[model samples]
Target: MEPLEEIDIFIFDTLTDILFDKVPGYKEVVDMGENSFFSDRSTYLFMNEFAVYLGGQIIADRTSSFVESSFD
Candidate 1:
């Protein structure tokens, strides 16, 4: 499997095809850095959108669920 960054780029490319001819920069702002441009609303929107994009992908599910479960 590719690294997280590669997977993210791949998904971003695919989403651009479905949503628009050009991918919006705001759509790719969900970085782990403290200074990411994405607001809370943008973060949630991106997350939900990616969840729908990655339906039935166990790697994605495990990654998210592991983090979520760790916080529980």
Candidate 2:
């Protein structure tokens, strides 16, 4: 695999693991062929729907909100 491909795989796998393990009730943690961690050529996709569902909420919140910086 190319370096870029390997990097993509690592990042995707890490995110999936975090989404399912650290996050709660995250469904659809696995990336199916459409958004697979391995590659576009990947044959299958697996995910936990509950984990992804919750993780989506968390990710959405992060993307939607901004935090203020304190001078202290």
Where is the poorest 10-residue window by lDDT in model 1? 20-29
lDDT of 2 by residue, 1-72 (tens): 999878867766775566445433232323332334334422223334333443565566644321111000
Runs with alpha carbons beyond 4 Å of true place in candidate 1: 21-72
Task: Residues 1-72, candidate 1: write the lDDT tens digits.
Answer: 559757666665565444322323223323433223223324346556545444533345646642343233
Measured by lDDT, the strongest candidate is 1
Superposition TM-score, candidate 2 onto the true structure: 0.38
Global lDDT of model 2 = 0.41
Give the Cα error of residue 9 in candidate 1, in Å: 0.0
After aligning candidate 2 to the native by TM-score, how far in Å is the CA of 35 from where it should be? 9.5
CA lDDT of each prediction against the hidden true structure: 0.43, 0.41
**What lDDT score goes with residue 16 in model 1?**
41
